[model samples]
Target: MPSSWLAALEDEASKVLPAVFFEYFRQGSGDSVASTDAAAAWDRYRLVPRVLNDVRDVDLTGSFLGTPASLPIGVAPTTLQRAADPAGEAAMARACAGSGVPMVLSSNASTPFAEVAATGVRWWLQAYLPEERLLAVPMLEAAVASGAGAIVLTVDTPVVAAKRDGDGPSALTQVPPEWLRVNLGDAADAPKARDLGVRDIAWLRELTGLPVVVKGVLHPEDALRAADAGAAAVWVSNHGGRQLARAASTAGCLPGVVEALGGAVEVYVDGGVRDPMSALSALALGADGIFLGRSPLFALSVGGEDGVRRLFSEYADGLTEALRLAGSADVGDVRGLEVREF
Candidate 1:
């Protein structure tokens, strides 16, 4: 919309990809008001840049779930990545590996965990527990065996919300069933457990022996509950407004989630974090890390692995510039940077 390269890429991708596929990646549930309003929500926060401090040589290096990363940004898990490119999640893994960043692989990934792990990227596995919790075990076990560093249990999607019907068939209809759930194999059709509770956090930890990041948390109380239940982190998300309509933006929910955790556990956020300024704002509000969802998918569609690499490069450059301008030498300095709602 604003003539940025990212905007141009989105345009290019829409033209190249199938209409249903593009719509699947871009659309939200119901009337789509929540998805439409998400990015703008970040704009309400006015950054108060500090003056008279050494601003040269800003660093963007950070860690996710105790693992070192080259940048504060990580790729959020998006389902059916192959819809964007033939290489799909493997290409994303390669790009993230090359950039020294982490990636969260979707439970419903088109590619298998072994192939993604072969890229050597620091990665976490995203899973939705089935009504029969054991139905998720084999997949989770395989992911861990393939080098998944953490388990990101997506807690929001108990049931996939109804998307507004598009002009043609849905994207999933176009994709082969085999390509949609390579991880789950025969159990791919199992329903997500609607009765998910905080106990599932410990269950996942015991099952995988990996730190569990409870994703899809919006309320501070939910964040606290996850922390108390032994969650290593609380991710602020509304499933990109796909799970629920009119949900609060992650940018709006982040501060409260962080404050509720009170530094006891890590806090991460995704949704509508399109630029460096928004990313810095999240850090200032005490977020331990920031993630990108559709942005990376858009980039993947435009240039395969290279497109994704270029996108991360732009973010790194932009974030460095933002940090220096805000008088911060590294990401840590932005932890409590001043912000005001405009």
Candidate 2:
């Protein structure tokens, strides 16, 4: 297996994928402070392991949103998967299915919902509201028909970030027409970032019987509001630090956000979480599950479906080892483990 997603797979993907496309994944907004700091924030925490806990057989399996997941990690919603391989989201779907995990398909997926959902993997749809209500409705309908079990409604990107740094137009614009047209078709469904408050989340719940998750929440107040608005889960993220330049890392704010929710709803987080120990720390702090953004795509880019499967297997193994070393018997035992600032 590859040493680490960053050290091996992503580095190899940089060479395999187009230079501009690779930059799109590599570059973060402004000074890239939040993106770079997310992992460092995790490093600041020191794990205090308990002894003689009998952790000989660590179990990584757990339930996510009522579904069985072999690991406490899930692939995050990312755009333009076809850029990595022609198989696109379909490849990822099969990979996740084989690995016994769920995948959140991006609203901007180049492949149609039906194609990816056909893989029979437990899947969720991540959507951004377009300016037109008509566009949003049909996409939701399609996701349901395609067998999506949940809806992750992103609420943070109310507008394009002014500090976003990158050269030239989005590589997405240059993508082949077939590859650029979001699964919703070419009817100008490009989401016009706009404000969405608690009411909108409530409306979504009424509209879809499927579990609704509010993503991109950084504040405990917003998380509480999400719970009030009927969100089944709250995804704590700063958009991988791409949305806000210096926003607090998800790890730094997770404890506060989780405390605010007070377990009113399941809480998940993403941002600067790339490896197993980082994942274990988040679980200990209170995240129900962890998400991987750029790393999975890098895996797909370097070795397609096989690479992704390998990545998931490696993560599960690494996490199991982390649990054992921390004297945890299983995923559940990880919660409330002793941890403090370094």
- All candidates' TM-scores? 0.97, 0.95
Model 1 is weakest, by summed lDDT over 10 consecutive residues, at: 1-10
lDDT of 1 by residue, 72-187 (tens): 88999998788888999999999999999999999889998999999998899998889999888899999989999999999999899999757788888888988987899655
Off by over 4 Å in 2: 1-6, 162-169, 186-193
Q: What tens-digit string does per-residue lDDT give for candidate 2 at 185-234?
A: 63344666475677777766777778899999999998998898889999
RMSD to the true structure for each prediction, in A, is: 1.3, 2.0
lDDT for every model? 0.89, 0.84
- Give the Å error, residue 16, model 2: 1.1
Candidate 1 lDDT score relative to the true structure: 0.89
